[model samples]
Structure formats: structure tokens, C-alpha cells
Target: MTPARVTGTPGRTRVLIVGGGITGLAAAHRLRERLGPDAEIIVAEQAMRLGGKIHTVDFAGRPVETGAESLLAARPEAIGLAEAVGLGDAIVYPSDAKPALSLGGELLDFPAGHMMGIPGDPADVAAIANAKERPDNGLPILEPGADMSVGALVRSRLGDEVLDRLVAPMLGGVYAGDVDRLSVRAVMPQLAAALERHARLTDAVNEIKRPPSDGPRKPVFATVDGGLERLVTATSASARAEIRLGMTVRELRQTPYGWEVIAGPVPDPIKIKADAVILAVPASPAAVLLRAVEPQAAAALSGVAYASVALAAFAFDRVDLPERSGFLTPASEGKTVKAATFASKKWPHLGRRRQIVRVSMGRLGEEALLQYDDPTLAKTALRELGEHLGMRLPDPVEQRVDRWGGALPQYTPGHDARIAAAREALGVHRNIAIAGAAVDGVGIAACIASGQRAADTIAATVVAADR
Candidate 1:
């Protein structure tokens, strides 16, 4: 069926942003800032609520995150946005707590000076390294602009023990991806850049880890006192956009004057016309929407894979746990649980309330685990937690299982090139832009930056057309 394009009234420009996730809402906020109150901005979210993966729920009479708990505060985008949305004072950093790795039935401190499990100092990871392994003679040569799987690169330089016991666990904690397929350039760009100049991987990592010649060090991570979702709520409330929940955007087509977004249910779909559009949904949905307008872009986006994972949050009345935050299980350990974060121990604010722990499960090729019922998944997490702590845990006072399907985008080898191709194809349409974790970085800060950049690009293109 041909999509109908409705025209906006004269002198007014309408911007329609699809997805209504953090990225989409950030775009809306940026649009309001750039275009002012006069410009019409609309955000369409298919889900009943906003924030996407940044979901928080009331547990044991206190708010807790079922999805992402903290924001990478090293980047200014998230902190800047928080301040803009009147949530500056509510920001809280995690308590000083060390993380450990679960290896060979023991919890050991994660090696120091490592980036995503890639050890900067070989001696630091002696606990996990093979005693029989000899010292590295030299790092393998990587051609300029070349890319390889993070696992392949690490294994080649550091050996199987480091790749399996160190790198995979760390990378899995973030991406829920297999190190053998994850891209070093996309996931660890700084290290990849440093590798081009240095011959040894450890030297490159050390260079990347070097402290900058600047002022006092800032907190690396932070979140709202109540919940990270507060940032989403505050941003949505501050944005001047008309947010429509349960509104699915089906397709996008260019119009003579602007762009037409075909959205809503099939039986009674609505065509909304806009001077510009931002596609901020996941890669799969975005691919379908862009297939009609930009096939090449869609093809590139289609190649982007995603990983699904589940979080099981448990609250206990009285339980004994270590002083450290949590422990991560390497894939080679063959554990059902990937990582466990002791919320009560990690956050002082929560520690004052009740003992709560969050267990994460699943990885890139572990979709079958997600098929299990919520109760079963929770039990799996509980069992794994007991095994890791080496104690028979009592029944939890409260428990919640939150499954996030396709929550993380896998930045495999050639990810940057694929994104570049899609952006080039999309450049032909000045009034349209794409932004989200799929094309850019995955962290909250990166998503915020991507959304703001897309908004800026669209605003500039529209202003140029008017001039």
C-alpha cells in the first residue's frame, strides 16, 4: 500500500522522532533546544513507557534498576543532560568497592591496569595466566585501519588463558557477546588506536590507561539517587515534544516538502508529516523502516547483530556476602550466570536499606536460555549465586526477573565500516538521520551523544533548506 503524506501548515516545521527510547528522547530534547518552542516535535514510542533498557522498579519499598544501573560519567553527555533536566543534585556515585572474578571456584580481585579484561601488566594477571606459558616476545603486527575480533587479537598476543579467563569475562559483562566475534576497534577504540603506534598490546593498553595531565580525577560512573530511570523521566518531562506511547512507526518515506512517517496500527494507521525525522529504534526495526528509502543503509543495518540477556534481582532478609561489589564468571567456567552485582554492597545508599543482588545471564549465542520462564531463570540465578559464594543461600524475600531481548548490539569486526556505509547512504536524505546504540557506542553517554548529533544534523539541514 502506498503511504499518504500529509503536509504541515505553512511557516511551521514538524520533527517526528521514532522509538522514544533514551536516544529518541534525547533527540527530542536537543530539537527543542535548537529549534525553540515554535518548532513542533513529536516522539513516538511503540512500548507503553519510555527509557528503553533503562528500566527501574520498586523492590523491597525502594527503587531499583532492572536494566542498566549506572552511566559512564567519563563522558559529558549523560551528566550534561542530567544537569539540563534538573537532576544534577540527585546524582550519586557508587561506593568505593572492588570487583572480583570467579575463577576455579575462587573469587579473586580483577587484575589492575586492564581495559575490558585485556591486561596492561602481565604480572597483574598471573592468577589466571598459565604457569607454563612463556613471556611474550612481541605483539603481532596489525595493519593500519585493519580490524579483528577482540578475542582473536587478545588470544594471539596474551594466550588462551588471558582471552578466556580475563578478556571474555570483562567483555561479556558489557556486551554479553563472544570475544571471538566482538570487534576491538568498535569496543575498545582507544586501545585499537594505541595499537597502531605501539608494537606490544600491553604497551598499547598501558598507554590507553595512562592518566591525563589534568585536574583532579572525576568519578568514572554514576546514577540517580532513586534510579537511572529518573534521568529518562526528567528528560521526557523537560522536552517540548509531544510523546505518544504505544505508537509504532512502521515506515518512513520522503515527501516533496519534507518526510512522511507511517505509524500506528495497520487497521488504522496514521501518516504524520515532518520537516525532519530521526530513526532511533533498534537495528532490526530501523532496517525495516529504511528498506524503502535507503536499501543499502538497511542492508548495512541488517548485518548488525544483537544479544539478549536477563537480569534477576533478589532481596534477602539476612545473608552473608563479601565486602566487594561482585564477581564475574568467565565463559570458559561454563556457568549459567555471567556476572553478579551486589547492589547493597556496591551502593551505600542501597546498603543502608536492604541486601539486594542482581544476577545477569545470557550471551550472544545463548538465546535459548531466555526461553525459560521467569521463575526458572530466577532459580538459575539463585543457584549460581550460591555456587559462587560457596554457601547455601536462603530463599529470597523478594525477587524479580527482567528479560531484555536484543538489549545489546554486537559490535563485531567491520562494525565501523558498516555504520559508515549506512551513514553515507543516509546522507542523501538531508532531513532524515539515524542514531542509537546500533550505529554508535552502546553506553548511555554514547547514546546521548549520538541522539544529539543526529538532532543537530537534521536541524542544520532543515535550516539550510529554508535559507
Candidate 2:
């Protein structure tokens, strides 16, 4: 966040954007294009720094992501934003190394031709899944517009082994959530759509997987060469908005002229008025701000829940690490560490100066794990990682642990309908919009697209009012 303040609030058109994460920053960047240079944009963030779930630290003389490591390269939003912000040259893709699953105290190859471990060909995953024989009863998996938990769908079609051994761990690694409660529609839209058209789960997954092509398959993930923080800072600079640090938006008031937000310290709050406002914070904070305005929207948003997670980064001088990129373990294994990434091996650009291993811990119901001290978390990560690799390892040259409490949104069933209802209720009011990972989808691309949509909505309304 920038410490500098604007000389004075603009008289022509002033827009206040709440939050300073990628979602909010993306909104401001698009708003600048929509409203032109005449409009004054103000970004109010509670934290002294931007990038909510995206952070990087200097460890072992190399920058590593303490939060999200890569962007969904297949999607254009994240990479598009990076290029728009002039960091196009820094985009790098992960190596072809595959990830393994720790099962039965052995490292097993991750199921292939699958969507989040839901294999298109049951035979391909039979080794890990051990799925019981189920007669395809000529029944379609899901009807159009219907929603269900991922676990229910997988369990019924593929069997308990697949759900517990493969799918659960695969989804948990990204969402920090249990498949039993996670919305299949929200997390795997492609598979959900395919389910509507196919009678078998295997057929549904087949539709979502890439078809055989003559050309080489492109990478699905990418990241900035140096660090992800550069993307955050660059987007903020590109927005050209007056960045305010350490200012919390207390209450939102709608005035006859426009909107007024009470922000800053409770004792001495500043009333910053704006022609329009964007509520782009997390679901909980966004709910608090919307309660006085639209309770229905608040009610819908309030229902959304979050999962906490911790990442422990270690740099070892020389130890026997596997040839694979990393490994993911299922919750059924009673493992404290859910996943580990061989950062240097995955992203070869990091080089072999020292082997960098990133381990992730905690799940949806394990918020207390984040309460543990950093040393404890790091120690547990190293111990579990060594056990998984079948080797007792030496001490790391350098190590760090980053705990992200309520970082990932656990989208329950009917998440789309809830968000749609919230947006519909908020639509009754003018000059107000909502965006973020909670309401939209999680991941860098989803948040960026969500913010862009909100900005476009508000910008169109603001412009129309002037006309």
C-alpha cells in the first residue's frame, strides 16, 4: 500500500473501492479505463500491504510464494492482467514433472486422464482407486441446474476408495476443504456440465479432459519468474489510485448524493464519500458492510465459509528427494501435512542452489493448526515430508512458515445460486457492486474476472447516471 495521499478529493467523480487484494486492484485498473482520467479512484485497504492470499518472501536467496504459487495459465484473466501490467516477459510455466500421492505408506503415481483425480477411464486409476464394480444403471449423474457435494457424486459412482484415496486429497490440496461438503458445481464446473450430458461419471470426466492433439499440450499453470508480489505491486501501480494503508472501512452509509464510508480508527474515523462503492473484501467483512444496506445479500454472503491453511518452506543443502515434483496425502491417512511441492524441481527457473520444498498443512476443520507456533508447523512439515519420501532428512539451511487463516473459501452446494441471489438483491440498490474469491470462484483468474465484472457493472451505472 502507498503511504502518499491525494492533494484533495476530486470534485468531478470520486469512486471508493474497498479492499486492496488482486480483486480490488483489478477493479481499480479497469475503472480507470471506464471512467477516464477525470475520475478520482481511491482504494481503501485495512492491511498495510496489498495481496491478501498472495505473498512472497526472500528465503535461501530466492523468492518463493508463501501463498499461491502459480496462475491458471489455461485461463486468460490472470496472465492477461500480468501482461497488461507490463510483466508479460516474466511469465514462466512449471516443468513436466508429475505429482505423486502418498498411499499405504508408499509414493504412488497420481491418476492420469482425470479431473481432480476423477479419472475418465476407471482402469487408469484402478491401481489407486480400488473402485468396486458398479453396474452402469443407465442413469445420468446430474441433471441440468442441479448441485451436489463432490464426495456424494464420486462415492456413489466411483466408490469409497476413490473418494478417500484420490479425489479427497486432490481437492483438499487446492481448497483445504473436504469433498463431502465442497460444491461440485462450483469447484469443477466443466465436470458438472459434462455430467449433465453423460450417464456415467467416467464418461463425464472424459468430456472435461483434453482431447488427443498432434501439437504439444500447453502447461496449465504459470507464475512470474521472480515472485508473485510483483504482480500485486504492479497491478496497484497500474491502477493509479490513491492507495491508503492501515485504514479499515468501519461502516457504509448511503447519502442522498451518493455513498459515504466511515473508515480509519474507531475513535477518529474519516467520512470519505463517493459517487460509487465496490465491496471487494472477503465474505465475512463484505457481509458486515452490506447488512445495513441489503440484508438478503448479507444473509447469502454470510453463509459462505472459509478454510485456513499453513505453508512451510524449507531449503535443504543436499538430501535424497524424489524425482517427482511433490506429493499429496489424503485426510484418511491421518497426516498432518496434506501436500508438499518441490519448488525448485517444479519451477526449474528457481535453480538447484538449494532444494526448496514447500509443505502445506491444515484443512477446513483444522483452523487450530494455524494457532501453532511457526517452528512447530515447520518441524511437522519436515518430519512428514521425510517420512513420505522414505528418508530421514538433515536440517534445512533456511526455513519459514506462513499461516493463512480463512484464506480459501469452501464453496458449499448451491454457491452459484447464493451469489446470484446476493447480486440480484444488491442490484435493487444503485452504485454498489460485489466481487472476490468468496462470491466468485477461488484462484487468481477467478478473482480477477470477478473484479472486472464488478467494475464494468459500476462503471456502466456511473456513466449512465452522468448522461
The global Cα lDDT (0 to 1) of model 2 is 0.89
Residue 22, candidate 1: C-alpha displacement in angstroms: 0.8
For candidate 2, write residues 243-312 as lDDT tens digits: 9989899789888978888888866677888999998899999999999999999999899889999999
Model 1 C-alpha lDDT per residue in residues 1-467, reported as the tens digit of each score: 44454445667888999988889989999988988888888999999999998888999877899989988888799999999999999988887787899988899988777778877778888877751223554654466878899978877777888888888888888999988899888998888788778777877888888575588667798888899889998998889788889999997889887788888878777888888999999999999999999999999999889999999999988898898889898887898899999998888877555789999999998999999999999998999899999999999999999999888999989899889888998898868899999989999899999999999999888778878
| Residue ranges of candidate 1 with Cα displaced over 4 Å | 1-9, 131-140, 212-217
For each candidate, what TM-score against the reference? 0.96, 0.97
Model 1, CA-based lDDT = 0.87
Scored by CA lDDT, what does every candidate get?
0.87, 0.89
Instruction: Tell me the lDDT of model 1 at 410.
Output: 96
The C-alpha RMSD in Å for every predicted model, in order, reads 2.2, 2.7
Which 10 residues in a row give candidate 1 its minimum summed lDDT?
A: 131-140
lDDT of 1 at 16: 91
